[model samples]
Target: MKRIVMKFGGSSLEDGDKILHVANIIESYFKSYSLIVVVSAMGKITDELLKASERAEKGDQDYIKSFTEYIKDRHIKALKASIKREEVQKETVKSVNELCDELYKALTGVALLKELTPRARDYILSFGERLSALIVGGALIDKGLRVKVLTGGEAGIVTDSNFGEANPLMEATFYQVKERLEKLLQDNIIPLITGFIAEDQYGRITTLGRGGSDFTATLLAASLKANEVWIWTDVDGLMTSDPKLVSNAKVIKSVSYEEAMEMVMFGAKAMHPRAIEPAMLYKIPIVIRNTFNLEAKGTLITDRVQVDKDRPIKMVALVKDVGMISLVGGSMVGARGTAALAFSTLAKQGINIMMISQSVSEADISIVIKREELSKAVNSLELNMLGKGVVREINYEDDVCVLAVVGAGIKYIPGIAARVLNILAKEKVNVFMISSGSSNSLSLVIKEKDSKIALQKVHDEFELDK
Candidate 1:
């Protein structure tokens, strides 16, 4: 059977009208495809829920109640507005109420204990996707399409015990997804599936961290071996440069899996970096489309694309609000297990090294981490390394951005990095460090303030706007 998974973001279903619009879009594709529809929480609902959890953890019960009430009202209102039928609306409202009750139970526990466990927090935030899926399913049913809502767990997306960021257990999830979803498809029923939130082996709720929803959808696509996966969002699709930062930014027609991965890793917001992995592994095509403008031919991501031989720089990307830390020592020269020790220490501390560069002389090794994790990474190095004689000096840099040039066959193409550097030089943007040939990407460490102008220059110089 020909099948496809379509995933929509919160921005595409933020309001009642937006939910209805999504329903209409789904209805248009209803009969023609065997579909699995995944949706994010409606708007900033997840953020609000996370904030409420934090406040509850800190012993703020009043704000928890007020925020929980607002969330309940918002989802219920959207559900009612989307499904106008009295009977269906009432029935769906009951489900919404039940979900809200469940959320309250979870939140009340957190507020009482004045502590929020990762497992508990996952359960609390999961209500966003669950509620959105239920409301969207209700609307679809009202439109005369047979629909059933399922959470990521119910849809058979099992993951490890990594509370805030769990990796899916693919082998188990595959069997479960095919058995459940294929049964639904055979019965001519559409699955309004929740994304991002999955259950661990112990049946405890776990979330797949940032961009988890998209990861959920892509995971389904890969497991079911779907023909394609379409990610519907607010923008026109992947652009050469951020449209907000560069006015002349234009939508890329198509991108190879490697290029797309590089772009996302370097801060392109169109899709999650890991979202492309499953599809790329299986050679399944992924499409990025705009919910508001469905007619436009959005970018297609696949295993390979015919490279524009002349313009090796497919995209210029930037990541802001990052911090860099370096460990330097003469003892580091030709040292054995030094890199491994540093990596192991950071891993134990749960610190993600976004980028790593080591000196050829082995005297220094620098890593870029999210600005928020800088303090933690530093403290970890100090405690674990300085006293233990892992290194002599630890240095820090903040207010930096990572700028990358991504394209397929970048290494094979001569002078690509040189051209990028020349463009930056002409624009007078200082480069702090450079790393090339890191999985189809060449990145430069630069000041955050220079990101926009540097991107603009690279975008124009490469004629990406054309």
Candidate 2:
């Protein structure tokens, strides 16, 4: 039997009308395929939940109450409008009550203790997906489709107990999911599934990182050996550049998995960056389509993307407002564990290194990180290396832009660097740092203020709008 998975983002399932619209899409797909539907939180609920956790951790009980109540009402309105059958709505309402109450209790505990554990945080954040699945499942029931709501754990997505960014145990996950979900499919039951939330082997709720719904869908696609995974979002498709930043940005018809991953790593939000891995490994194609514009063919991403050989540059992706820290000292030359120590230290502090460049002379090494993690990364490095004479003074900047020109063709083409720099030169965007050579993508660092203008120039230079 052929199988396929469809995932809807928050924008596609924000309210009752949106939910009904998505349900119709699902209904249409279910006619021929054994369909698995994965849903994210109904618009902005996950963000609101994170805010509630932050406020609760600061010992703000009043705000916790207000936050939880607001989310509760949001779900209630969605459920009331989505499920027409009274009995189905009644059962989903009960599930919603239990989930909302559980979230409230967790928030209350965080307020009283003034601390939120990774476990508690994951548990609190899960209500969005939980309620979303139930609402979606109930709505499907109204259409006379047999449906069941499964949380990530119940669906057998086991992971390590890494609270905020849990890694799924693929072997166990595949075994458990196939054992249970395959049976449900055999019985002609559609699984209306939650997306971002998963479970550790310890039976604790753990979440895949933000934008994990797409990851969830791709994982299932790999496990089921599905023909393809469809990720429905708000945009027409993956564009050469962010249209808001570059009005002439064109929608790319197709791209390779590697190119897509590079674009996402450099902040293109095409889909979850990790979504490409499992699907690629399993040789499953991923389709990015707009739910509102269903007729549009959207973009097809495969292991091998065929394009004009002359123009291999698919997109110039931009990461704006990044910060960089350079550890410079001649005395640090020839230090063996220097790079390891610095990176491991940042790892321990949970700071992600976005990019890195080191002088061949070993006089200095600079690392770029997100602006929000700058303070923590710097403070942790300073405190840990205060006495260790591994390096010298640390100089950091808070405003930098990262531009990644992604495509496999980059490595094959000559003078790509000259062309890139020439475009930047025309835009007067000085490139302070460049990381390239034997890389699938060329990364350039520039002033944050010039990010948009620089991107437009690069896009035009590549003639990607054509």
Which has the greatest lDDT?
1
Q: What does candidate 2's lDDT look like per residue over 1-466, in tens digits?
A: 6798999999999999899888889998898999988999999889888889989999999998887788778888998898898888888889888888888899999999999898888988898888888888888988999997898788888899999999999999888888768888889999877999889988999999988899999888887778999999988788888888889887889888877887777777558888789999998999899999988898888988565666778888888768999888777788788888889999998888988999899988999998999999989888876567777778888988788888777877787888999988987889878897436789998988888888888888888899
Clashes of 1: 0
Error (Å) of candidate 2 at residue 271 is 1.8
Q: Please count the clashing residue pairs in each candidate, in the order shown.
A: 0, 0
lDDT of 1 at 242: 83
Clashing pairs in 1: none
Off-target runs (Cα >4 Å) in candidate 2 are 112-114, 344-349, 375-393
**What's the CA RMSD of model 1 in angstroms?**
2.3
Worst lDDT run of 10 residues, candidate 2, spans 303-312
Q: State the lDDT at 298 in candidate 1.
A: 87
lDDT of each: 0.87, 0.86
Q: In lDDT terms, how accurate is model 2? A: 0.86
